[model samples]
Target: MDLINGFITIFSSPITMLFIVMGSVLGVVVGAVPGLTASAAIAMLVPITYYIDPLSALAFLYVIGKAGRFGGSISAILFNTPGTTAAAATILDGHPMTQKGQAGKALKTASISSAIGDFTGEILLICGALTIATFTKQLGPPEYFAIYVCAFLIIGSVISSSVLKGIVSTLFGASLAMIGLDPITSEPRFTFGTIELYNGLSLVPLLIGLFVISEVFTQASHDHSKDGRHDTIKAKNPDDDHLSMAEVKRCLPFIGKGSAIGSVVGLLPGVGSAVACFVAYGEGRRKAKNGDKWGTGVIEGIAAPESANNAVSGPSMIPLLALGVPGSTIAAMLLGVFMIHGIQVGPQIFETSGDIVYGLFAAGLIGIVLYFLIGWFGSAFIGRQIDKVPPIMIYPSILAVACVSAYTARSSLFDVGLACLFGVIGYLMRVTNLSTAAAVIAFVLAPGAEQALRQSLLLSDNGFAIFMDRPVALAFFAIPVFAISLRIYSRMRSEKTPAEMLDTA
Candidate 1:
């Protein structure tokens, strides 16, 4: 009944529907462009949420996140360039099909598989988030703090090729989070006498600088003028342009397996769509009848990765909705939106904002359908259109929009300057191969972690011995230790193989 009302809420508003439509279209356009990502688009548009109703704002951005995942397949298939990191796995078979003049077939396969996978993940989210929240709500400050520690370690360890670099990025973000007044004492710590620093850094500027403006800086340094253009391959036959029932049947098993893999991965904090897609692709290949033919334009190859890539969109939100922990960069951005709207996330969110939560879920379903149709009927056209606009032109416009968006957040010149400063910092981090996503997630989680730790300590009668009494907290703390150990063991084992070492690098 709540879900139905949620649908009604979205349907009742013409403006909300319009935003969903616009977001879907824009998401595809943005994701079809190489070197642009859904995260950057969401960061640039976050300020616009301040002017709209919470449901409308959440729906708009949420839909874009959904649609954008599918849109990345457009460029991956058409140009061999992944519009987003998640689409990297798709290129294995996607571009090969395009080179074989079966681009339409690959695109359609991707569209169908992505929709099915995303739908599966959404259903799991709607069913599982509330259930998980029930248990999460029972947790005390000690358990919450333990969960935070687990997240920090897992994210820092897995997000980058270099575990040390990833941990450093996480620590850097945590340090930045400590720059303002102490939450408990209300005394300033690192303000350095700047009044603006008293409030710490605004998420708007940080997000814009790290994801949006930094990309602009990176793109600006690249010489797009000398980049070679690849022409879109035309289908050799009408059948090559349309997905057949036989093809769908053959791809169904891979799609299902990929969706399952993606949903499970999404539930784990810090493991993202890129990992899910590649894992799904590898698993599908290992199990497929045509295993040897996996990489040479097999439709199953496209089905596996595309499905898993988009499937991560929904279940990744589970941690955010249930435990107030963001599992991915997109979820971290959404966390900012939730705070901006004065909506509390986590277990209490269902009781406090059920309508908006369910409506967001409804919006996600509608978005999946919208993007599926667009991908099926118009992806080729959208891909060609994006190809016409060179990166040299696209990035400057994005830089301008990012600056304006930053200023719009608080209408402050200082925020804009802060954004530019972080832009340089972000550029350096990217060039240094550090995990910006890990840093952003840590920045968002640090305050809550600090509060939980302080609160737990305040309640403790026996100092550090309090954690010893809590089994759940102990279990939570153990997760990161186990994960880090497994990662180290795997790295040690892989070191013996030169090819595996190269792949790991």
Candidate 2:
């Protein structure tokens, strides 16, 4: 088959194999360090790809993104610090497992789950993108707006312990998104005279400030002893170091379900691994036999989020390959790479760039294997190294990297100042139990949602009825209404006392 031939072609090249391995290793190191992201790495590498073969460039960056996501779990499990936003939910139970001296088992669970989930999503991308693209191409702005609204409501409702706080946090993000030039008019709405503000806040600064810098502040407040012995927590027993067959069997179902959720979420533009991981975690908890123990250092907790996050990597490329639309920031960078190579995307790409596409797919398959082996064999040593480093020394270095990374995104000192500002705000949010995760995701989705809604209104003379006129849009609008009502009803029922329940029964 052509697919088999593609695999052979990629495997025959020694340089391609070397790049895959090197990229995977570099990605793992970068992801394990806080404040550095896969997108940033790819952004930095764009110029380097100019001299390399197109297939090699694409393969190297693609593998880096995939491996980086998995690498995030290493720090999340061992240090209670998630290097990436997607690994946030992993901290719920991952750190607990470390405290229980089962760091090795947690690492293996993350590795195996991530590999299986990535494989499933890659398969879906290969088989289903063409079919999905045909349908997605038909969707108008109204339908897209409806989808964004649903995501906003659903994510806000599920992410926080308090629904009001969650919704408020999301709205705050949306409001900040309105600070730049209007998407429709190109008129500055909230620029306040600064040229840098004209483009609005960069995502890189906001991300580093919110996740990485805020975490540093949080860790500083903790009363961790200076004793090096507490730096690294080790497995308490031989049994704690290995993942058993029973544990793997118990986790298989959750891994499969997480993969499915991630694949579906990935196909939608602007929805990334951060949302997919939490969504998968919520679903896994709902179906778990020991749901009450979900946040108490369980294997399923690590499995669900890790699998779902990595799964998003593959399917997130679907829009790019089939529709010429980049779904995430990484995909957008890859788009630039494709353009540089003069390989057109979309439906016609199959005919014009068949060899490159197939080779890219083959590289993804191999990259998964390489990263899995690396994670499995290298995790213990990595954990020990982290443990050996003192917090005082490590955090200052991380702070420097955070500032530098934020500046490198745009070569602007103003952006560095903006990052520090957000760092303070993020620290306050963390202390207040506000959902920074919801806020960040909402910020990412806000511009697209606003554009879609505005475009739809312009296309119709009947105002909001344009949504009602479209059955798909109508259904999407109805989903949030139904979900909110159910949540309210459940809360009402749960508020009743035990005596009231008994009397009603």
Best by TM-score: 1
- Which ranges of candidate 1 are over 4 A from the true structure? 496-505
Model 1: how far is 58 from its true place, Å?
A: 0.9
Best by lDDT: 1
lDDT of 1 by residue, 1-505 (tens): 8889889999999889899998899888888888899999999999999999999999999889888888999999999999888899899899999999999999999999999999999999999999999999999999999999999999999998888998999999888899889998999988899999898889999999999999999998888877656787788999989999999999999999999999999888889988899889888988888978877999999999899988888999999999999988889989999999999998999999999999999999998999999999999989888877777877888899999999999888899999999899999999998988999999999999999999999999997788999999999999989999998998887654422432332
Q: 205 in model 2: Cα distance from truth in Å?
A: 2.5
- lDDT at residue 311 of model 2 (Cα atoms): 90
Error of 2 at 166 (Å): 2.9
In candidate 1, residue 418 scores what lDDT?
A: 90
Show how many residue pairs clash in every candidate, following the order shown. Answer: 0, 0
- TM-score of decoy 1: 0.98
